[model samples]
Target chain A: MYTTWWPPITLSHSRRDQLLRALLWSCASVAGLMLVCIVAFLILESAPALSHPGWRRFFTDAAWHPTEDAYALWPMLAGTLLSTGGAVLLAAPLGIGTAVFCQWYAPAWLAVPCRRLIELLAGIPSVVFGFWGLVALVPLINQWQPPGASLLAGICILTMMILPTTSLLAQASLAQADPDALRAAAALGFGRWGTLRRVVLPSCAAGLLTAGLLAASRALGETMAVLMVCGNVVQLPSSLFDPVRTLTANMALEIPYAAGRHRSVLFVSGLLLLLLVISLVGSATWVRRALRHV
Target chain B: MNAGRAWIPLLLVLAATAGCGDSPDARQPLTKLSITGSSTMAPLIAAIGKRFERRHPGVRIDVQTGGSSRGVADTRSGLAHIGMVSRALRALEQRDLVGTPVARDGIGLIVHNTNPVGALTPRQVVALYTGGMTTWRPVSGKDASVVVVNKAEGRATLELFLKYFHLTNAEIRADVIIGDNEQGIKFVAGNPHAIGYVSNGAAEYALRHEVPIKRLPLTTASAPPAAGHPAPSPLARPLTLVTTRRPPALAQAFIAFAASSHVHDLVAAHYFVPLAA
Candidate 1:
């Protein structure tokens, strides 16, 4: 008995499936809509500054004097890049090394504790880390140098913060490399070193790169710890010792007090940061895709 | 069976959305008066609140500390019954609120006790903050980079300092951007060459407590009143109580209690200058 007609009163199996699909679609759409609304709102709010005469000057000029209408973002933009880049540079090697050690070198009993330790490190709140950096690391730096809160201190703190993400992800990806390949390499009169280099390392290169990019993104978005350590100076950092202010730190420190044109300028800088992050993630995905094709 | 099973998920979705709604109020017996804003005014307000609560047994006074702007915003939004502000209302902010001067405070520059800087001419102070002079040699005769510590934006002390110096916040090249008076004092206290400004009351309290920080006086007598107060030395600003509308009877009583001459000892105890009799 094939009843092809639709059930109007009762929910048929297909109709129920359709309803569930629609509900899931609505949930997903809500998330997507939130992101769209945020981007649209930021752009709309920032349009006045974007359309101003000094708008182009924002990218070119280095002096960020909002009261005098000099709305430059070079220093902060550079600071964000330098700090994130420094963190990635320090964390990547350490993270990859730890990942490699855990995957291939560590004994069976040691591996679980090592991974657990890294996860615990990740679980610690950022403010706690910032406090430690303030009470512990700042004085340590001060003992070595005069002005303790500087770019180096920021880099060091951010490096510690991002390490768990980089290493954990890299470790997961490294685990996916074919165990058979290692066995095959061993069978071919290759040493353990040779097996890791030729068989294991090449297979996980893209994953390692992805981990680095993800860690970099995390470092880029960090606010409190960097704000606490970076000293919030609005200057082009000439050396690692010089204090610098990031876009996030600037927003956190100034947005409370900003009004009028100053307010517009801060919103525009936020838009700029949003764009920078999008481009960073975009490029990372593009690279990952390109690497997959290769 | 199918309809009943389907209702479970639908009911869950509804429940999740509806779960956050408030439970019906249990009758609150206490007459609550919320006071928020101005960390500078927090201790004074807290002390006064205690005595007020003792006098009126059923009344509760809630004191909170954020910046002065939070006070203004909270009062405007009706989130707070009264706001404590440490600076005079700007011309634009004067609308829609009534301000009562409760106490006086002065903005003073603090330096490490190791630094021998006694007083700065208004010109020298401006020059130092603007990064025109980097070393302490001109101000205190130390061969080190002058670590100019400035306040984060929107603080009353920062606003007063900027106005007094005839400088915008951006013009100053600060090595550190501290959040509050205590933080500014701490930064200056820790570093040998650091100079930062905070409320005179806070600095005085810290100094008296043997904190290794000293308040610097402004040497320019007859410096314009627009800069701060014409007090001839310390830059004086008022700590105010603000309300968006005529407060409720209880709130008005609290206001009168806070403003009366009886609180003079309380004001002086908190290290703020008592209002002239």
Candidate 2:
């Protein structure tokens, strides 16, 4: 009797399976389509700027006075790159070091709390971080250096904002390390630090690089914290103490009052930012693949 | 399980129907009055709107801020019943829109309280901003370098400042460019050698809170106040509410309410100077 009931049930199950597969495929395509639409919209909106005043002015102009038609984007672009690069250079080592210590060296009682705190830090809003930076960090720096809101303040705030991201990803990568390899290193009479250096680190180099790339991307797109602390001067910073404005910060500050060509130029900035992020993600993927062969 | 699965679609249909029926027009005809523009006046108008709502039931007033241009544009397009313009309307705008003056706000220069400089002439102020004079010693203050803090482009304060001083944006050698009046105040308050300008009303309110900044009196060489009379502000502009040339009855009522003596207390509480009766 059970055998006779099977054919109809199997037929119905296959029908449901086909329906689910079609639904999921459509959902994925919709997401991809939405991304395409956004790119198209940005290009369309920025076309007026690209044609008038031309792209040359964007690269060569001295300052970023959009209302006056001086659209030099180099200073803000440099500000964004320098701040993001400086933040990643400082944050990556600290985050990875914390992850390594918690995984291997920290006692159980300490490690649990440390992990929980990192998780908690990740959940805090970026605006709250910006406010705290403005209230606490800017004044402290002002004591040592006049005009405390500068590129250095922006980098410090960004490093704090992205630490949890790098740390959590590094911890995840460390967990995937082969337990057999660790024991083998111990059997070879290698010290704990030596084992980590020779075996554990080499094994997860790709994952660690991925973790760093993700954190860099996050810092690149951060607006509020950098805007609040970075003094927003449309000039290239000569020193760490000098104030600078990033591309994202410039867009946020001016987009509300922007009109006509000014508004289109802001969209151009958005398009440039999108391209940078894509290239970053592409390079990360390529590096991960290259590291696998080694 | 089949019965439960069947109810899901039914429940979704019921939810969709309920959402559609909950639209304001279907439930009741609510007359919503939309007001837009000028971040400076948004707070004041919002407070007045709350009081108006309490008095007139079934009337709604929506207030939004996106700078004065948006206010002007929105009123012309009929997107808003009234637009809050922080400055007086130009002749071009006055042709299509009628402006009702509600209060007065003046743009004034501010510096940290510790600075010895008490007053700056219009010429001296222009020189400091244009990078002609870079040190405080030139302005009779400390020997330290002067940090010029300027408002970003498109701000009404920046526009008024530039127009009054006859200086273009490119001429300003700003060490730091800040957005909004609060940021400008905060930056000046933090840096002892920095000079920035913001709304007089906003600066006065900050002073009440003991923010370590002082507003300098703006004196022009061309016209000095008569003896026994206080010096009038050279940077003052009217805070006006703009409407179409022929406004609806409801908009007219609200405009009258806004400009009347009844709301003078509300205007003064926000630190704005109430218009003379």
**How would you encode candidate 2's per-residue C-alpha lDDT over A158-268 as one tens digit per residue?**
999999999999999998989999999999999989999999999999999999998999999999889888989888898999999998998888877777899899999
* Candidate 1 residue lDDT tens string, B143-235: 777878888765677778888778997778787877667767766777777888888778878987999888776776565333422232457
Q: Please write out the lDDT profile of model 1 over residues A34-79, one tens digit for every residue.
A: 9999999988888877888357788887677776667778888899
lDDT of 2 by residue, B1-277 (tens): 5534756997999988887632222324446788999888898999999988888898989998988878988899877879999888989999999999998887889999999997899899999999899988977757877888998878888989999999999999888888888888888887888899998778877988999998787656346654632234678788889999887777888989988898888987887778899
Cα distance off (Å), candidate 1, residue B259: 1.6
Estimate every model's Cα lDDT from 0 to 1: 0.81, 0.87
Cand. 1 Cα-lDDT? 0.81
Candidate 2 chain B: worst 10 consecutive residues by lDDT? Answer: B21-30
Q: Which candidate is the best by lDDT?
A: 2
Residue A20's lDDT within candidate 2 is: 63
Candidate 2 is scored at a TM of 0.89
